[model samples]
Target: MRLYTKDEIQHAVRLNTTVIDGIESAFTSLKTKKVAMPPIMRIDIPANNGEVDIKSAYIEGYDSFAVKLSSGFFNNPKLGLPSANGMMILISTTTGEPQAILADNGLLTDIRTAAAGAVATKHLSREDSRTVGIIGTGSQAKYQLEALTHVRPIDQVQVYGRSREKAEQYKSFIEKSLNMRVDIKNTPSEAVNNSDIIITTTPATEPVLKAEWLNEGQHITAMGSDAEHKQELDTNVLEKADLVVCDVKEQSLILGELRSCSNSKLINQVHELGEITSGLKPGRTGYNQITVCDLTGTGVQDTQIARYAYQQLNFKEDDYNE
Candidate 1:
């Protein structure tokens, strides 16, 4: 069997419009019965401020399927380690055997998650988008900006983080790599105001971005709340959104931004992203619409990204055999 290390996976994976389109296709596949993806299985190690999530999916008539094991330990960085690490396993349906093991250690997850944001923002945000406001300065924060720039004309970035030092570091990274001016805000509200697109990457149980701070014709992508007890945007903000979208309606109701809402009627009104991307429904029909995309990070994304990783390495299924 072929085994890919994290270094190789990192080298193979890239953020681009094609990656975003692939993720978008995965969603459509899920919507159209071309994929089979089960709900995310999570186990929490609360004593250590951590959780492990297991996800897998199968693309119909595809060469392989992928099972992913992902874990997040929030306190690891204090000890000079990354907070999240995991791997993926590719199994051949044609041969019904193991094909490749991508020891990516959550690298593909970060890429696919951010790439989903790029797709959502591209379809939901206004065409003239140029400013981006972000909360959190972790790896996800960097990926979010990098991915969004692929779809938008981002020229300015506003950042709000728990630490001024980390925010400054993020500021330097963005300014150098993205070649854009960054404003380090004292609060999320300050960072959110006057931005064309807003992203929250922090895993906060409480709301970080207030609903009242939002303006008309802005798009928000909340990627932090993938599990229970995690929320980044105010519930009222979701309630007030003219068009609230989610990657998966079932997953969103359990853990995404919709998990906080009290109104069942409003919750049922949420649109699945696949429905919009597949032309079954519309996305951002009006310029003044307040749009929000709740990203829970689906298993199909893992399957598709694993396939991309395999292709990037030029691997053939016949090359891996017992």
Candidate 2:
């Protein structure tokens, strides 16, 4: 019966090793523990250029599970509002009753998504990777970069956005907050070229990155294609990658980059991130190999992050019981 606001949750959860490891552990549990995670339920509001996604998961041995509701209204920024917002509810397993309502206003989603990217990079990307290429200048663009610093020795950044003004703003934010050098690129190709780790965060319905732009020994994280119509990488990019991984195989086939790919053989070759994280399969077998991880977000991440945030707050149930 604990109700927490976004401000309270923000102070409790942050982008740190502890948070990153918690998310990584969720991935591990997905494979080893067989987490009961259902597919994401989405409702599209085409008239408003927005979509709402409902996700939830029940992990074994957990005292509580999380049900998260998050929305993305692409046109919100035009009205000076954020594009992402929502909340999560924690329900106890034993009692089958509500435990806590985490009204994080999508902050938990943002953090967990960014943490998932960091986990992908930590296990797949090269240890020596430093330079980063970011596509799309949004909240995620900044968050993705911030999360990368925790996993990689990132020092340089290149960014490409449709809006020059937003790109400039993002550059300033990164330079001031992370103290890293950032260069604005005229095209996605320009931004991706020569970068050790390339992250695509746009909500584009078309491919913003091409296969020809990719280089050997580089890692790419494609996280924007959480919908069936949204795609950031050319289908050829996935085909060309030496190793292609996904947050979930079935979900990726329906909602991620795999949904756009035509090659059935390539789709069959795709592996789940849990496989790599659980050590059942190898990650980055060669330093020169190209790796691509497609993340469409996952319910297990919500369950884990919500639980972690609740624990971090040091809540006492009796004090807030209704």
lDDT of 1 at 275: 87
- Whole-structure CA lDDT of model 2: 0.92
- Cα RMSD of all models vs. native, in order, equals 2.8, 2.5
The lDDT leader among the candidates is: 2
lDDT score, candidate 1, position 59: 84
Candidate 2: give the clashing pairs: none
| Local accuracy of candidate 2 as per-residue lDDT tens digits, 77-172 | 999998888999999989989888999998998899999999999988999999999999988898899999999999999999999999999999
Every model's TM-score: 0.95, 0.95
Which residue runs of candidate 2 sit more than 4 Å off their true CA positions? 46-49, 315-322
Question: In angstroms, how far off is 115's CA in candidate 1?
Answer: 0.5
Q: For model 1, how does the per-residue alpha-carbon lDDT over 61-134 read when each residue is reduced to its tens digit? A: 78898999999898999989988889999999898798789999888999999999998998899989999999
Q: Model 2: how far is 144 from its true place, Å?
A: 0.9
